[model samples]
Target: MTLREIMRYAGTLYSANVAASVVTFGVTVLISRDISRADLGIYGLFQAYFLFGAYASSFGLAPATVKWVASGAVDDGEFLTFMALRLAGISGLLYVAAGVAYLLSFKVLAVALFALPAYQVFSVGLSAARARLWRRREALVLVFASLVTSAWIFALLLAHHGYWAPILGQVLGAYSTAFVMIAYVMTRNLPRLRWPGAWRRAFWGTALPVFLGSAVFAIGELADRLVIRHVLGLADLGVYVMALTLFNVLNKPVHMLSRVLLSHFSQADHGVGHAGALEIVRINLVVLPLMGLAAAAVLPWIMPFLLNRDYAQAFPVFAVLTVVILVKAIELVQSSVAVAQNSATSNMRAQVVALAAYGMAVFFLTRAFGLIGVAWAVVLRWTVLTVVQRLDLKRRGVDILPSHLLVRASVAYLVALAFFPIAPWFMGIAYLALGAVFRLWRAPRAWRLAIGRAQN
Candidate 1:
């Protein structure tokens, strides 16, 4: 696809993501406000386990599916069959694990384990849809599923169901999406399932490192929550989780852009080897830090009203986390480049080192400081990952941003941080104005080139 086409598709996907994110954010706010803080903390704990289970059951198969489907190396039916077989094997083990947890009276852990297969199925379906460039269909699926989940949870809350409402709503949503996607696939002229030896080998070969890396990263992501729960208690965990939820909502646009760029860069011509990577770096540098500043400026005032006055304490944690979001946005672009280049090992190594560092940092930092330390630990982890990924890309001859651009962006971020506490509204307005100036100066030429390419 031409650059214009990619941008158009990215815009579509971003719109869909934004809509879903907005609804999801609303649902989260409702849950936080309505549910007890201790229940919210339990929910957060369940989520951490759910994420771990989902990533573990995926075994990197989702990305493998995307890579192969985009490259036209695997037929849909064959890929589906492979995923089914893999899911069966993984689910069996997970079921046993869940049973053991249940026997031990670990209800939430068991529930999270039971939800794994459906989560993986829904995830893989989305991956497949993206690989096929079915952005509208993918968007519809996501929005519809989120709406269903939100509605169910709302109904349960109205009926006076407690924490189980969201948990069950999540499981129901996963199954609903999985059923719809599977039915859609069945409507296609897909061949009967068969065991294909070569494809199995190919899938596992590509997936193992991605799986290991994702699993490690997933564990690292949960470390802070676990520490808070153990050391600080459930109410604090609830506050931190709510803060992170807000961070995720604010960071959704960058996440969507990175998702689109992964597929776009995978297929685009890289004659000089760094065109896609450089474009991603430049775009993120312009967009992410500004978004982070805006969030930092606004979240402090809005969060209390959104959740409760009790959550007002989470503002400082949220502000520190905006830096984490900024750094993560850049790191995500680099990681997408690595994925697109079929150099998953590079990312795997970077994630391994970063996860180790994150684990150690969270342990000590949470001991020294409370929830704020967890936020800072996250920023430190992402910074290390970004630096390592940049070095890896540089060694591979990719032209990253110039040092001057990095310095300028860093200075702008520091200035925004300094201004946040004193005059947050002014900080937001000034950052937006600077972002506007940067876009006006930089984007026109890029748009012209994209249009030229599209016309050609």
Candidate 2:
């Protein structure tokens, strides 16, 4: 796809993502305000555990589908069938194990295990659409799922269902959308469900490393919350989770871009060496840091209305967490590049090292500084991951970002965070205006080159 096409799709996907984030944010606000802090913390833990289980059961099939389909290396129908069957079998075993172990409440376990196969199916279906360059379909499916889930949650809450409301809503929405998407794909593609023997091997070859990487990464993602809950108790965990909930708004665009880039980069002849990678990095450098600044600036005003005064202390931690977004945006691009180059194992190794470091950092940091320390620990992990991934890309002869860009963006983010407590709106507007100027200065040149490439 041309850069113009990617931008168009990015806009659509980001809009859908924004809508989903808004709905999820509303749910977060409702839970934070109406529900007790301890219950909110339990909800947080439920989410964490469900994500880990879902990712584990997926076994990296979603990205594997994207990579194979985008690269024209596998039949979509065959791969989809394989994935569905595998996910179903694994999820059934997971349900049995959960039942035996009593890992979560019956409500939580039902949603986590039963809904997961459908969710993974939906995810793979969406990835398949993305791989086929069906951007609108991809966006629509995601929007549909998120909206349905949010509506269900709202309805359940109104009906006076307690914490189980959201979980049940999620399960209902996931299954409903999964069946719809599956039917759509069957009708649209008429994909034959034959096993492609060699391609099946090839898929596992790519997916296994990613599965290990993602599994370990999932653990790391949950580590902060788990450690906080264990070390500081549920109230502090609720506070930290609230901060994360707010920071997720900034993360929505980054997630959307990663999906677009993974598909685009996988198809690029030069992979990460293509000019598009550098353009992506440049765009993110301006957009992400400014987003962090804006969040820090506006969150103080918004928190009073959105959250209870009990969560008042979470705002500073939220501000600190925004910087993690900038670092994470960079890492997202790097990991996408690695995947594009079929060097997922290298990225996996980097993540393993980063996760270990993160685990240790979160343990000590939470002990020392409480909630803020947890935010700093996350920042430290992402920074280290960014460095490692950058070096990996450099070794692969793909230096998409200059060292100065990263250093400047990091410093700007810190300065914005520091200033937020003193002059929230001014710092926010000032940094956002600077980012706009930077975009205006750089975007035209980038687009010219992209257009020139496309024309040639």
Candidate 3:
């Protein structure tokens, strides 16, 4: 597909994601007012486990699937084998989480255990559809899943089911997505567990680094919640989780953009793709920080309107973590370049270093300063990740950005942030003016032209 086509498809996918995110966000907002903070915290831990399980069990199968399907290496038999591979790899994670859930008793969280792998199935289907550029089908699947989840949660909430409303609702929603996706894919072909000798090793070789890298990152994420829950109790964890939920709602645009960026990056020649991705990095260097400023300015004001007084403490954590979205957006673009270049070990290296930093800091920080320190530690981890990934990309000749530009952008963003609490409207205006001074106001046109020129 041309840059135009990929972007058009991205727009469609983004719309679907927005709709789904809105539904989930609406439920979250409603429940935030009604649900106990501790219950919210439990749901937060459930999410931590879900994310860890999904990534740990994936074995890089999701990306590998995208690579294979997008690269046209997956014929009928190949697709069947891939599907079988995904199922097999995902089962152990389900079993382990289920056992934990049972030990905790048949609670709202048991639903969490089931949903972990269920989400993987949902993810795999989307990965496949995304690789094939099946825009409409993928959109429908996402929207339907969100609708089902919202329906379940609302019903349960009205029936006075408490936390189970969101917990089981999320689980069933994941299953709904998986069911619809599997039903569609099954009509095309059946899954088969094949004993292909050489190709199997070849696939694993390509995927293992990605899997390990993702697993390490997932461990940090899940472990952070565990520690927080153990020390500060569920209330703290809930507040933190609530912050993330809100942040994610605001950050969905970048998330939506990332959904197709890997496909778009992979669709082109490696050098061209890397360049295209770096171009985006350049634009985001201006766009993201200011975006963060805008969010930082308003999120404090918005939190009260969204949540009641019970979760007022969440605001501090949320304020500290606003930088996460900015850093993550850059990492997303850089990550695509790493994966597309087929030097996946670079990702492992960067993530390993970041994980080590997070591991060292989270324990001490959580103990000392509560969730605020934990929040800062989370910030440190992603900042390290972006820096390490930048180094790796440059070593591989990806030309991430010039040092001068990086420094200037960093300083400018920091300056804007420093002025924000004093006079936010003025800060926003100053930030926009700086972006204009850098000629980043023309980025929309520049990005389009660059994409066209850089695409193969």
Candidate 4:
């Protein structure tokens, strides 16, 4: 609401993310350089499985916790106790699944990826404890653990042989992240238990719909990998995975920014007096495009250095994905509004439409054009989702599209793209220059608004 509060929220997110991103980006760059394309692809397949398993394990409880916890309607200790129980149960289930997959076939390791879930559940517990304490710094510690562990494992991977590096690195990192959270909890003296009521409500209220939506979301996201693995083999999947990793980076800021928005906006008053929705829109406008242009300029330069020359072809893939990030940024901000309104059902509907459109587009396009078509399909999917989400928000009297914001975004991106191919360093300059120009163009209005809110 206030500039201080807004900044505190933003700072909490970006600071922790900056640490994690630096480590991730560094390791990714190193791994991309050191590992063969085929190895990378194999690792990617494993990662895909891990992400799926992790999300499934959470049962959507992560996002739901942010919502319910932010509302301050429940006892912190009680909620955390409940979260601990659910997480432990989920972790146990995941281990069982992993064991079965291992016994069935080596291939099932890709689907039954246990390490991510094992790490994620503990990470979830830490996050829940942080929510209870309202301690942002404490929350950040887990991220730091992830970063350090990832870097160490990445280095180890460079020394080691086989696909096991990625699996081990990720699984070990998950464990480290969980351990940090658990340690923090013990120090805080938060009550830990296998509480039944909290578990029931959390699953019913948060996890179930989320799991359904995640499955749909995962299908759309993982389709290319599935197709590539089955059709073209691990080598082709390697190329695709390289491109996908860049997209994931581009998507992270949007994802984190959305979390910050959901955490605060969901709890704040949303009446006419609040203008919470409008404020959210303004903040997003100021934020998303600036980040997008930065990506456009930075990725091309970095990709060559990170990946093997064979993967140079993925530059275009990166470009297409940058567009996807911009579009997704729009959708993410809008989705925050839906979350703020407690309209999970509406959010689910929107995801369904986007997923269907994405799947169809990818199927047709990929069939005709191969891997490049898959990239284009991603762009198309995000574009359509942005439009649909905007319409939905408009009906709710939330205006996310600002003309001036669009103008600024277009100008900044065009300028960055022009400089991108010519000189990466120059593109960085363009980002700074354009960022300054955009800030002046907006007259520090957002900043001023934040200040005013903070003072109030």
Per-residue accuracy of model 2 over 1-456 as CA lDDT, tens digit each: 766677677889998878787777787687677667777677777777778877777788888888888999776667757876787787678768667545555655555666677778787878888988888888888888888888887887787645676667777888889888778766765667886557888788778888888887788777888898999999888887788878877777888878887898888887434667667676676667777777777777877886664788788998888887778767887888788777787677777788878877887888899999999988887787778778776887777767656666665566556677678767655655555544422766666644555421
Q: How close is candidate 1 to the true structure, as a TM-score?
A: 0.91
For all predicted structures, in order, the TM-scores are: 0.91, 0.91, 0.89, 0.84
lDDT of 3 by residue, 1-456 (tens): 565565567678768877777778778888787788888888787788778877877888778777667776546465666566668667766767788878879554556667777787788778888888888988888789878988888777887746767777778778777777778777874646454444666567657888999998998888878888898898888888887887766676676667677777777776667555555666565656666677777867776876674666676676567667667757887777677667778888999999899989988998889888888898888888878888887888776555445445554565666675577656667766776775443666657654675442
lDDT against the true structure, each candidate:
0.74, 0.76, 0.74, 0.64
Better of 2 and 4 by lDDT: 2
Off by over 4 Å in 2: 103-111, 186-189, 271-273, 428-444, 447-456
Pairs in steric clash, model 2: none
Instruction: For each of the candidates, give the backbone clash count.
Output: 0, 0, 0, 4
Tell me the TM-score of model 4: 0.84
Which should have the higher TM-score, number 1 or number 3?
1
10 residues in a row with least lDDT, candidate 1: 447-456
Which candidate should be chosen as best, given lDDT against the real structure? 2
The TM-score obtained by model 3 is 0.89
Which lDDT tens digits does candidate 1 get at residues 1-456? 555666677778778877777778888889988898788888889889998887777789887777777877776567667778777898798889999999999999998998787778788888878888998998888788777778877777777647888887887777777788789877988777766547677767777778887887788777778889998999999888888878877777776676676676666556532554455555565567777777777777776777663886577788888876557656776776677676677677888888878887887888788888888898887777777767777787664545344435554565667776688767656655654654422565555645654231
Task: Answer with 1 or 4, whichever has the higher lDDT.
Answer: 1
Candidate 4 residue 89 Cα shift, in angstroms, is 2.5
Ten residues in sequence with the least summed lDDT for candidate 3: 402-411
